[model samples]
Target chain A: MPGPDLLSSQGLRLDGRRPNELRRIRCKLGVFAQPDGSAYLEQGNTKVLAAVYGPHQASKSKSLQDGVVVNCQYSMATFSTGERKNHPRGDRKSQEMSMHLRQALTAAIKTELYPRSQIDIYVEVLQADGGAYCASVNAATLALIDAGIPLRAYACACSASMAWRNGQPEPLLDVGHVEEAAGGVVLTVASLPSTGSIGLIEMSHRLHMDYFDVVLSRAMQGCKDIEVILDRAVREHLAEGWTKQDVVVI
Target chain B: MFQVRKLANLTLFVTTTPTKRYNKINKSDCFENSILPVHFSVYFIFHRTKDYNSCKNMTRHVKIRLASERVNHSVSSNNELPRFYTPGEVITGMQDFMRGHGTYAEDDSLKASVAGVMQKVNKLICIRPLKSRYVGEIGDVVVGRVLEVQQRRWKVETNSRLDSVLQLSSVNLPGGELRRRSEEDELMMRKHLQEGDLISAEVQSVFSDGSLSLHTRSLKYGKLSQGILIKVFPSLIKRRKNHFHNLPCGISVIIGNNGYIWISPQEKSNLVEGDKDEIANVETQTVSRSERETMGRVKNCIAALVASKMMLDDTSIMFAYEESLKYEEVKDLLDTEAMLDVAFLTQHKINYVDED
Candidate 1:
């Protein structure tokens, strides 16, 4: 079984989509003033607030690095999901997410510029509908910008799931938890969309050897499509200035 | 007579009124009408009137919309505003200050304010609403409710957090220099004043903790010589602490925002129709504190009488109160155990609830 007959007979995936369409994305930057940078992003009903702390100093134990060290912390609020979790962070899942976040974020950051310093990225999921990791990455990207951290390009992540329709391979973008639970081959790709290069790719569940490239490319394309929207938002945000209207006197 | 017949019908007098239709039960049974709910808002839901067969316990839902009708003066009360507010954050619906991240301190001069942990950590927040009260400054007109008779003075519950003292000298009795009101004055005073009476007064001085000390040493405000009284929430009456408010036709005194109103008719009656007109003028022409107390009592009586379906104007309200006040028999009945309890009404097989 190429995973539980992923596509329904109506040519729709488990969550009802024509496979390639992505979930809605709503993002806001500079939502908080205390932090160097902050952003609020909602991918569908999943909401995440990302805050960037520093490029300041390398604290005692974790100091020596050849280049600027990227530290990422991923935590979810207890009430964010349908089944509330007892612990917000320090869980194995969150630890794994932190590692994955560093890998993708480091690819997009110009880490060499600030040698021996640390950039701390913290993402907290407030509400979780689905595609939480992708949302965290997108939100963190905006927060890094708000923190005035240097980036090579906007780092956007999107997921694609392969739904095996009647004799044809269908691709689903931004697979929600419901669709993921429905047992499709989910392929998540984190990339610098403009450069058309994959920063990170992870797949759960197995598809045909030949269909892997198609699924991976579709996920990458979803990332690129998201980058365009996010870049436009960032430009508009920077051009318009911060929210607490900067008082100007002529 | 024809108007009475028309009012008896379920359908109102072809011309619709918000209160007239629902007030049939109120007018016929104008006993001691005390409006239970002080807060009247868009969200005021009418609860089902439960059945309890008794006289004292009997309660009917009475809602009256009195737009117009004139009255007397009252003393004004006030509330102290916080010296400072949280920057960018708003304190809404209640007394609690909303502490946002933006609030800052100016070294030792400013206080360090932080949002309470539980308040911010939780998803829901609750704030209790506060009613506005009177702040006694240099000079302000206020309305006060006579709470207790102490010596020659009456302790008037002004809208301020503190109770004000209404001295005997400030009140205008029939003769100007009628030195010392006696026990006979307390007994016969209901003819001129009583419990729950609304009177308009003036803020003589501030009694330390922002409470008002009132005086009505003026002709315009003193004793309910005439006109109606009303009781309402203490917050609605807005008073600008000033002396002498002379309106076009008459004068008005703002009692604390609560519902105490003392209204005396202007010499020339500028005739108007319905409760709609007076509501527009509630904040106009400051009623003295003493007059507000007098008027608030009358409005309560009207609210009760009107709620019970009695189409009584200023004349009938006074008639009922006068009839009830001077009646030694009714006062005696009020003392009886059977009358005090639900026993009498229940024995008579009347389906009513007792006053709890």
Candidate 2:
């Protein structure tokens, strides 16, 4: 038996959505004023808050002649996850997250305009479910846009998983904590969903060589879906006129 | 008196719980968050961990300077306690503290990066969890106490800088007049709910100023009964929600990840039976029997350490909860497959009944 009752006989996943359905996405930009830019986003129970501190002076070590140094820090709240973490940041896991963040956001930000400058994009994950990294990248993108930092396009991220239930390979969308822990093949894609160009993609565990296309395609589809939602949020945030996220005077 | 100084990392006036309270830093300046409270005060600057360690290693002398008072010092504690530093003066005191007793080498940028904090005559001490968590955010579920009830709204002290308001309308008795009362419900005058009623509520909003407002809307989040409430450091409790499901009918345990937990009999169970420890080996204290019970394993070790007064923190909680989880009742509830699942021949239900 592959697995009991992950996809129902009706062909819906555990949370009763079709295999293609992503989690509910609700986002708001300008959630806070104390930062140059800020945004809060909720994807299912996963909540992420992002604050952009500067396009201020570049530190001596970080300055680049051709572009701005986009400094990104990703920190999950200690109580954000089911398991309690002793230290929230400055830890190895967070260091890895920080590095991943810098990688993803540096790609997204158009740094050439702000040459010899630094933009600090700090992402704080208040609550974490499964897709924290994807949520962080999405939230940080919104924060940078809210901060009025120029970007190539919305850098949206999403993850997909595949479980061969009932002898047929089924691609899962926006994999949640349960499926993630179930040791399925997870494919995470960070893409300029508008143009269908992937910036980053990671896979955990292995899948049948044949199932890679379906899984990667579903994850890219998730990225495109996320880009729509994020784009709408950016428009609504811009249409609302003055947002608090752009007003961090300090 | 120009109460010109706000106590930042550097400025504090530790008096002998002193009578001569002046904003002008004379000889009686105290260290910030006094390690010792009385007699002498020093204005030590806030140094980072490495910085403090380096300074502690150095025996170099630093000069102390006092600013000339714009107003002549008249900090008279009249018939009433003196209104020492005006708020503006306190802010100024904080600024002066930020400017650590002037030195050619002093760097304002270094200290300014650290938030300039100030406090009263007795350095207002703050328990900053360097890794401290933010207490509450909007829409978070929290369990708190009705510490000071005024009007219709009860001031609930959630895990935050200030207490939040839980209006009477948000809560219902077994049955109440209003199905759901409007905001018109008088906050200052409540129909029911006195001080000290332990209630469960949702954080409604966090004011820009960092105050909180909570609501007790759901049937599940309301008055607690039939059990005890334990308060620990809010940060100690994890702030994630999980259904402690399969809770025995007689017991309903509402644990706030914020370390405030409310336990009550589910209108079925009574607690009079008391927590009788079927603790094996209390009489004999042997290895074989003690190892059989998880509590026996830890109770012996921790009691030894505590008897020796070795301070315990995270490592201890892990060890303690690990052992505690092994109890048949707890293992049944927790089902920690990784740490637990050691077979005990005698089949029994899990202990430490956890209600999700």
Candidate 3:
């Protein structure tokens, strides 16, 4: 149900971005001193902070014999949205977001390495524009990396929406809040781009079966692009914090 | 073709902000697009204008900036940088190399599972992370706080994956090393080292589950009395033959391999050794004002070195302490500029010693 006005006459989206362009992403790793690993990420106007603790002793009930338990909690600030929200978390939507986060992150972490342990990832959304879930996944990935937890590959998430221009279906990459409210079919994909693996896929509103492939691929491409940016941030963090002792093991 | 265009735009956006208008539009778009309150948009605009004005004022006495404006503290070393690998990056073909820690073998190739520099010893290749929870080794000294007192054992948290175990049989009781642990001793465990009491111990063994078993068998290792415990990254602490140092400046420091540092007065140990029965009495002994000042200075010096992510050892600590003495007051060492100065001076001295 995306309106024709979703794209301008010049072939750019409402936010003056090309249909294939993602939102500007800025990130910093090890933002916190206490947590084992922490990161702050901003994708356009949406801001998220993620902290990873443990791979430590799991409590008696949560411990797994085969691998580590990935516990994730996603909470948005009361002021994250334009409206003043009463509850920060524990809502049904927050619970679902937390579960989706675990599904995406568990695929990236090499859990088998730390059996009988738990890795707790807590994501706090400071601002929510659009694609908050995708930003949470990306921030959590950076936190896990900052914690030095072994991972099979970086897990990146991105959301794409279908727009129409000149009687042709156009897949928009990195949907912002405005585009999301425009009644477009949004496809969110969490993937390990390097490994060509999809951890989780979700769709909101219905799209024609023929255009599904296009939207999905665009989202996957966004994830791949995000993986490259995250990889660069990790390398930059390592360079800054790398001491001589890190290189020459005593 | 779309992928190529996307990549090009991404690189362009990352390198330079030709898309500044897009960024501004994105911000304003959220306000206009959503049914959010008009006041919220006004507030955003007000904050933006205020920030812009602050940037224009050159001689402002008090400067306030957002968290996003915080400076990057990473200092690139002068030496040739080491080759670093990230997760899932293939290190080499797994024809002969044995994958070790932070690495996994998949698809006939050894891939790094963590971001760090690689270490190769013969056929064994391992990647060590820049920082992580302390992975204990046998004979490594550690300072841990008692978390739980369970059946004949005390659960001590040593900043590891699992809470380390300190069994009653492993520790030397108050009477002597040869004294048999009686049923009475089991009941008296809480009287000895209760919850939250700090203790210095050595890693006796490592369990198959990767948890450490610790022992306080030596006279040097036992319950820590009144002292300041400073926790740094375990990676910062260098592995040395001597972790306990009685500094020339009249304070003793126990640099636990787990990165828990105990800074206490020097004379306290001598007092305990002289009258063994009065071990509990030592806690009541008030530290002199001068001794407390020296301990504070030493603590600040260590903080400086840790701030710079320098390798911590007795020599490095002492060099920092000596360099910090020029700054008269101990509290002054806490300043960011002073900390950087002390760290820089200590690094110079350490490099000088290495060259010799």
Candidate 4:
């Protein structure tokens, strides 16, 4: 066991959040003027920007006939982490993140709507605070909404870690960088909360099978909470320019 | 000018809440008044929802809503602003309504697949987003830059989902309209329109893949020269019958439906018939200082209208132009405060004119 400081005697997490609490999520759609759809989402200390382009012609190599080709690229800024990384993308970690991002987003997008088309989603992490993947997924969801792409439901992702409190395994919601570096088992879940379907689940480090269900449910609950925030943001975006076309009632 | 003052009051009523943070007020009626203030919680919600003590700068993208003006000003309008729909929200439980773009039928109910306002045309319902890539329709005017020269076809980027195609057959040859497109014509394609050249064309057809086929068959619809191009959200541009207008202010504006606006000096006295050399030389002719100033003013005025989320038509733009005359300096309109002021005055003028 590490320092055991993840949860204090009062059951407060290291960041002063309650075990069941999540970080503050603030997001805005259509941040960039150039891309078809773009969004910036800040989850506590983690900041991510995502842009969606296309549902247009795909290059011959990447084209798909059965449904729209969903291409995703994940990259982090040079100053995003504490170390000042040498490369932004094409590395081993970013390539894996790119693949994982595509899997989660593809589950939400209605690909059949545009056969033989491709939607390119590019995510750039401006700040890294442990749950960067979760923030990136949330930001990409908002960007897809801004692009007017049809989706089954909002795909939300959240992270949880197993922490001991009062001799019981208490799963903390929205694990931050400090808690992650504390050598605890972190469970990340991306799902369509409305549909109760999991798109992707990733776990780093080992946890007993007896404590798995509680940790999973906590992360799932966090996903449900994130969906609500994203939904309200979308509605607010719609209301802002609801009258783009002057309805001609004949 | 008294009408202009009344117009200003109306706009002030609609848009005075941009700087008002949500923590200051908690009124329900304020939600319906405008869109951006409702976003006050977007910044305030973070502080209110969870208490995390860390220094971070929250940058809010300013959104100004002028749509409320149309709803509040029009008397015959019985429609409340269309109810917003988000992805997976059931549009109707009924199976009778046929789904259109931005929507789909799921589990025996009509559900919205996009985040936007729902538009119903009889039995077919579609969701039109506030902003998206340009969806080209036939007979629509567009300004696009050439992306690639591929054989007889020139791929043009029209701010659409895909690059639109401009075929050799669709354009009028320099010498004559009836001339056949020979091997030589294909070779000279880049000479006529190289990579990065801007042109104004009309949407001739929409392919099955959603790409548009553009044509420059008319003399007025060809290579654009010596003008400033301003791009806004395509939805800001109102679809009008005549997008090309030679404003009384001595500048011409092309309000492309694709959100590309080109402003240039009005063609000097309309070139005489069959003078291809003179028409070509018009590109080389220097634009005078006064004409350049007028174009700059028009460009800024259009930017002001776009920033406010107001419709961009010739009349609205002209009204904005007249309102901007007080600033004297064309570059002053680029400032956020000055842009909002001009947009407010323009809205007031539009609402005033509508009342008459």
Model 3: how far residue A132 lies from native, Å: 1.0
How high a TM-score does candidate 1 get? 0.41
Model 2 ranges with Cα > 4 A deviation: A1-5, A242-250, B1-356
- Clashes (backbone N, CA, C under 3 Å), per candidate, total 100, 36, 0, 0
Per-residue lDDT of candidate 1, residues B240-315 (tens digit)? 3442333222333333333355555443245363455563464355656654444444444334332222322233
lDDT of 2 by residue, A87-120 (tens): 8888898898888888877776656655556778
Top TM-score prediction, candidate number: 3
List candidate 3 stretches off by more than 4 Å: A246-250, B1-77, B268-274
Interface RMSD of 4: 3.5
CAPRI grade, predicted model 4: acceptable
lDDT of 2 by residue, B26-143 (tens): 3333334333333333443333333445444543434333433122211111122211110001123242332321111122221111111212233222111111113567766677
Writing each residue's lDDT as its tens digit, candidate 3 over B139-215 gives: 99999999999999999999999899999999888776798899999999999899999999999999998999999
- Candidate 1: where are CA atoms >4 Å away? A2-6, A242-250, B1-356
Pick out the ten consecutive residues of candidate 1 chain B with the lowest summed lDDT.
Answer: B70-79
TM-score of chain B of each: 0.37, 0.39, 0.79, 0.77
Estimated TM-score for each candidate: 0.41, 0.41, 0.88, 0.84
Model 4 TM-score on a 0 to 1 scale:
0.84
List per-candidate RMSD values in Å.
24.2, 29.3, 10.6, 12.3
Name the top DockQ candidate: 3
Better of 2 and 4 by TM-score: 4
Comparison by DockQ, 1 against 4, better one: 4
